[model samples]
Target: MKKVLIVGGVAGGASTATRLRRLNENLEIVLLEKGQHVSFANCGLPYHISGVIENRESLLVQTPEKLKKRFNIDVRINSEVISVDSSNKKVVIRNNGEEYTETFDYLVLAPGAKPLVPPIEGIHGNNIYTLRNVTDLDKIMEKLKEKSIKDAIVIGGGFIGIEAAENLQEKGVNTTIIEAAPSILVPFDSEISNLLEVELMSNGVNLLTNNKVIKFEEKNERVVISLENGNKVEGDMVILAIGVTPDTNFLKNSGINLGERGHILVNDSLETNIKDIYALGDAILVKHFVTGQDVSIALAGPANRQGRIVADNIMKKGKTYKGSFGTSVIKVFSLTGASTGLNERSIKVLGKKYEKMYLHPNDHANYYPGATPISIKLLYEKESKKVLGAQAVGVKGADKFIDVIATVLKFRGTIEDLSELDLAYAPPYSSAKSPVNMSGFIGENIEDNLVEQIFVENLKDFDKDKNIILDVREEFEVVVGQFEHSINIPLGQLRERYNELPKDKEIWAYCAVGLRGYIAYRFLTSLGYKVKNIAGGFKSKLKI
Candidate 1:
């Protein structure tokens, strides 16, 4: 019988082991885990701190004994793979201070990633913690119970850090998130991400952007974070949720090709450079589904799928993983943010000729109670008209919008395909024209040259003397705010006052959102006036 030895018993390793057993009952599968728990919901770790996930046992997806009986696979916890001898197809493992060698016909490495704890002064304080697994969660839980966590500081603004801060605040603890970037949730473009930032601040979560911690020191029984800008913040506890690095140090001399950041280099089959060796999960480099560039996306969805693919190839079933789309969604307090494919910043960096448009639509029907606005941004290749990426932010419907785009990306579909998708609709669930459909319609218009649009970021490029900024919103709405040097002309009064507007200069029109502005754009264009709707209108301008 063929034997498969797997290292790391989380999403990728656990899936591979059970899958191997399912494919062939006679196969020998040995799964080694460095941690005590073989498989647990690492994503639910933060929710546990907030008591949202009250039952700790519920997080453990499977136990070693359970796997042994159900899948007939040998599961060993606390057995750390110390080194890999790829040439000999063997691994050195340490368990309870005892070393042993495990030889296998096939070896799968799925050692995921470890929390990146920077080497800074006083970082080793007892109150400083990094959550990665059940062990890490246990320590944090114990600290919460053992001490009074009055104020907490999260030293990152990514998914884990944001989630941790939200949960901490739910526990009635004052939480502050310190991020080095200009904004949080880097996956979403700045305008969309800013909406989330506003939500965080409104919910009593202190957020500090464009800041980094220089050092840590314990003062008055609290951790003092000294910022690089010479500011100090005191907190009872500090979470080092900065980021993660591939946990591939043991394979340094194992002859496996690794990326610059130590991510294992693997082919489409999940096969490493070494013969009979495979790698999957966050520790491996994968091609970007849209960009076709080698990148590292530490997402659970792709890792889970990659696990099944690796098992299929091991059984000689022939499966190929084209790439990962980096599709992700996060709930930050009341607002949710989601994105898939490339953002505008990335498109610019790649020097791709792209066109983008933005829209503000209700998550559901305006007639329905409790309707909230969703900010949607779509990016596509100008030449191919192919949908490159999209982002959505709102109280709800973010996941739905991004999921649709992610599916379209999988089929390499174009913007027109999005418009033609017959999505289900109900007053409480979605608008008559779903946000997805609205985005498609808008894209189709741009593609067909029905109307031209300009973004607020490039408003300065329009010469003041040569271009007229027209606000199509009602006078009452303009009381709240209006763009600088913009003229107000309500859509209802545009027909009677069309002649009053300048016919020589270009007309840049906007409203509360894009619908009215779009209407004005078409009405003016028919009368032979140069007109362009500012994307997303005043709502998007507010975010910037």
Candidate 2:
């Protein structure tokens, strides 16, 4: 009988063991973990912090006894794999200070990752914690239950940082985020960062960007963070969600190929350089679905999928794993932000020819009681018009937009194809032309040059006098605001008073959103006037 030993028992390891057992009853499967709990709901840890999840036991997916009894798989907790002997196919498993060797025909490594703990003075203070697993959750809960945590300072603005800040706010704690980068959510473009900042600030969460902590000092039950910018901030508790690094230090000299930062290098089938040895999840690097380069993406969704793939390939099913898009969605209180495939930064780094369009569309029909506007930015190949990526933020239905784009990206769908898709629609749920279809429809127009376009963010550098910047909103609507030196010509009066505007100069039109501006652009372009409409019109000021 073939023996399979899996190290680490989170999304990847547990999945591999359970799937392996289901595929072959005769196979010997051993699952070991270095932590007290295995197969817990890690992603739900943040919700539990705010008492949204309520019960701690609900987070536990399975116990060692349950896993073994249900699947007949040998399970061990607090068993750390100290070393790997690839030549002999053996591993040193240490448990309770006892060392033992386990032999295996195949080995899978899902050591996962730990939050990066920088070496700062007083960082080991009792109040500072990093959330990663069930153990970390209990420690945090203990402090919260004992009334030890009051004001919180979360370092970093990535996924964990943002989630922690939001949940802390839910508990009525004064929380502030210290982001080292110029913006939070570095993986996304400025649009998402802009929206996230608004969401956080409006909800009374203080945010400080471009600030790095140089040192930490413990002072009378409070922690002080010294910033490189010569500022100091104090908090009753500090949570470091800076980021994660692969928990694979033991494998450094194990002859397994690792990337520059200690990421295990694996192939399409999730196999390492050593034969009969595989690695998946947060510790290993896999091919990017679109970029065709190796990247370490640490999302539970991809990790779970990787676990299933490893199980199939180990069973000799001849199945190959495709890459991941890193598609993700996060709810920041009431607002939601999501993105799929490559962002602007990734596209620029890859040096590809791409064009981007920004549009603001209502999530549902305007007549609906609770229709909300969504800000969407779509990126595509300049020549082929292939949709590269998309990002959306709104109070509702934002995740749906990104999810649709991600599905289309799996097949390299083009702008025309996306526009032609027949989506379900209703007055309450969506308009006849859904936001997703509207993006594609707008993209088709931009590609065909049916309407010339310029984006609002470029207005800072644009010469107002050189071009006629026309605000096509009704004259009364201009009372709220309008670009300086822009002429007001309502859409209804545009055709009747066309001669009042200068035809010799270039003209840019804008409205509440892009719809009215687009209508004006079509009208003026047919009359043979040099006219373009702002992609996202005057109402997009909120995003900026």
Q: What would the per-residue lDDT of candidate 1 be over residues 377-398, giving only the tens digit for each residue?
A: 8999999989999999888898
After superposition, the stretches of candidate 1 with alpha carbons farther than 4 Å from their true spots are 542-544
Clashing pairs in 1: none
Instruction: Quote the RMSD, in angstroms, for model 1.
Output: 1.3
Candidate 2, overall lDDT?
A: 0.88
Evaluated at residue 220, the lDDT of candidate 1 is 81
Candidate 1 has its poorest 10 consecutive residues by lDDT at 535-544
User: What's model 2's lDDT at 19?
Assistant: 88
Using TM-score as the measure, which candidate wins? 1
RMSD of each: 1.3, 1.5
TM-score of model number 1: 0.98
Q: TM-score of every model?
A: 0.98, 0.97
Clashes of each: 0, 0
